[model samples]
Target: MKMVFRWYGTGNDTVTLKQIKQIPGVEGIVWALHDVPVGDEWPMDKILAYKEEADAYGLHLEVVESVNVHEDIKLGLPSRDVYIDNYKKTIEKLATVGVKTICYNFMPVFDWIRTDLFKELPDGSTALFYEKAKVESMDPEELVRRIANDVDFTMPGWEPERLKKLSPLFEAYKQVSEEGLWRNLQYFLEAIIPVAERNGIQMAIHPDDPPWPIFGLPRIITGQDNIRRLLRLVDSPSNGVTLCSGSLGANPANDIPAMAREFAGRIPFAHIRNVRVFDNGDFIETSHRTSDGTVNIAGFVQALHETGFTGYARPDHGRHIWDEKCRPGYGLYDRALGIMYLWGVWDSMGTSRKGVAE
Candidate 1:
C-alpha cells in the first residue's frame, strides 16, 4: 500500500507540508482545489500551483479526495450536462499532473453528516461524533447553522454558501428516490468513467458518510451490495469505490476486511480509520489501534497486504488529541499516530509473510 496524507492546502490547513513530510511512509498528498466551486472546471493554473507546492516538498499529488459532484448532477437537473462536461475537463487536467485516482461522492445535499464536530470522548480527546437520534430529530437548518457557525475553516460538504439553499436543495431531492438517484449516478458514471479510463484515473466514489439516508435523503452507496451494483454501473476498471472503513463501519455489519478482500482490485483509494459504535447508534472516531474502535484496522491492512494492493491508503478521521486546535477530523497529531499504527501493522504483516516463506 502506498500511504498518503490529506492536506487541505497552504493557508487553509493548520498542518503544514513540512509536518506531513516528517510522517514516515507517507509519500503523497490527497488534495484538490478547494477554492474551485463545484461544477466549475478546475483551472489549470490553480492546479499547477498546488502541484508546484507538493513538488517543493517532494510529495506526489496523485490522489484527490474529491472533485465534488455537484447537486445538479446528483439531482439530475438539465444543467447537469454542463457540470458533467466540466467534470470531464477536470479529470483530463488532473491526469496531466499525474493524479492516478480521483475520489468523488454522489451523496445529495450533504456529502457527509455528523451531529457533533468535537464530541468529547471519555479519554478527554475530542473526535467527530454522529448521534443518530439528533440527526433524526433536529431540523436540517438548525444543524447547518450549528456546524457552519462552529468552524472557522470551511467544511467540505457543509459549505455555508451551499447550505444556504438547503430548503430548495432538500426539496429538489424530494423528487429523487433511491432508484432515481441510482439512475442519475449511472448517468454520471457513463459520462465520466470513459474520460477517467482514458486519463488512467480511477474514479472512486466515496460511500455515504453514515452509510444511511439522513434527513430523508436517499443514500445508495452504503453497503457492499450497493457497491457491487455501483461497479456494474460503469463496468470499467476506471470505475471504483474509495472503500472508507469508518463510514461503512458505523453499521457494524459492513465487514470491512471482507470488503477489502472483495473489492481489492477495484479500490484505488482507501480511508482507514476506526470508530467505536455505541449501543444507542452513535459513534465516535478513535485511535487506529484495533482495541480502540470497532473497525478491524489490522485485519483490513492484512487483507490489503495479502491482495498485494498497490493503491493509495490514508489514515482517515482521527481524534483531536494533544489539544490540537485543528480541523475537526483532519487534525495532524492523531492522524500521524494513526499512520504509525498502520505502518506497524503493515510492516509486521510483511515480516510474518517473509518468515512463513522462509
Candidate 2:
C-alpha cells in the first residue's frame, strides 16, 4: 500500500510538509483547494503550485480528499448541468497535476458528524466522539454552532458559509428521498465518470460518515449492499470508492474486512482508522491498533494485503496526544504514531507471505 497523509495547505494547517516527510512510509498528501468554493473550476496555476510544494518534500500528489459536490447537483436541479461541467473542468485540471484519484461524497448538508471534538480519554489524550442519543435530540442549527465553537481550527465539511444556510439546504433535501438521492447520484456519475475515465483519473466516493441518515436527511452510501449497487451505477474501472473504515465502522453490521477484500481492486484510496463502538450506539475514534477499538484494523489490512492492494491509503482521524493542540482529528503526533503501527502490521504480513513463498 502507498501511504498518504492529509495536509491542509500552507497557511491553513499547523502540521507542515517537513513534519509529514519525517513519517516512516508516507508517500503523498490528500489535499484540495479549500479556498475554491464548490462547483467552480479550479485554476491550473493553483494546482501546479500544490505539486511544486509536495515535490519539495520528495512527496507525490496523487489523491485529493474532496472536490466538494455542489448543492445543485445533489438537489438534481436543472442548473446541475452547469456545476457538472465545472466538475469536468476541475477533473481535467487536476489530471494535469498527476492526481490519480479524486475522493468526494454525495452526503447532503453536513459531510460528517461528531458529538464532541475533544472527548477526553483514559490515556489523557482526546479524540472525536459521536453520541447517537445526543444527535437524535439536538437541533441542526444548535449542533452546527456547537461544532463551530468546538475547535479553533476549521471543521472541513462544516464550513460556516455552508452551515449558515442550513434551513434552505434541509428544505431542498426534503423532496429527495433515499431512492431520489441514489438517482441524483447516478445522474452525477453518468456525467462526470466519463470525463474522469478520459483523463485517467478515478472518481472514488467516500461512504457516508456514520453510514446512516441524520437530521431527517437521506443518506444512500451506508453499507455493503449499497456499495455493491453503487459500483453498478457507472460500471467502469474509474468509478470506485475511497473505502473509509471509520465512516462505515460506526454501525456494527458493517464488515470492513469483507469490504477490504471484495472491493480490493476497485478501491483507489483507503482511509484506515479505528473506532470504539459501544452497545449504546455511540462511538469514538481510537488509535490504529486493533485492541484499542472495536474495529479490527489489523485484520482489515491483512485482507487488503491478501488481495494484493497497492493503492493510496492514509491514517484517518487521530487523537490529540502529547499536549499537541492541532486540528481535531488531523493531529500530527497520534497519526504519525498510527502510521508506524500500520507499517508494522503490513511489513509483518508481507514478510510472512514471502517466507511462505520461499
RMSD (Å) of each candidate, 1 decimal: 2.0, 1.9
Indicate which candidate wins on lDDT: 1
In the range 1-358, model 2's lDDT, one tens digit per residue, is 8899999999888899999999988889999988888888888888899999999999888899789999899999999999999999999988888899999999999899998988999998999999999999999998898898556666678888878889999999999999998999999999999999999999999999989899999999999999999999999999999899899998879999999888877999889999999999999999999999988899888888888787889999999999997888999999999999988888887555532211
Model 1 residue 74 lDDT score = 93
Off by over 4 Å in 1: 351-358
Question: In candidate 1, what are the lDDT values of residues 8-96, reduced to their tens digit?
Answer: 99889999999999999899999988888888999999999999999999999999988999999999999999999999999999999
TM-score of each: 0.97, 0.97
How many clashing residue pairs are found in candidate 2?
Answer: 0
lDDT of each: 0.91, 0.90
Global CA lDDT computed for model 2 = 0.90
Candidate 2's error at 248, in angstroms? 0.6
Candidate 1 local distance difference test against the native: 0.91
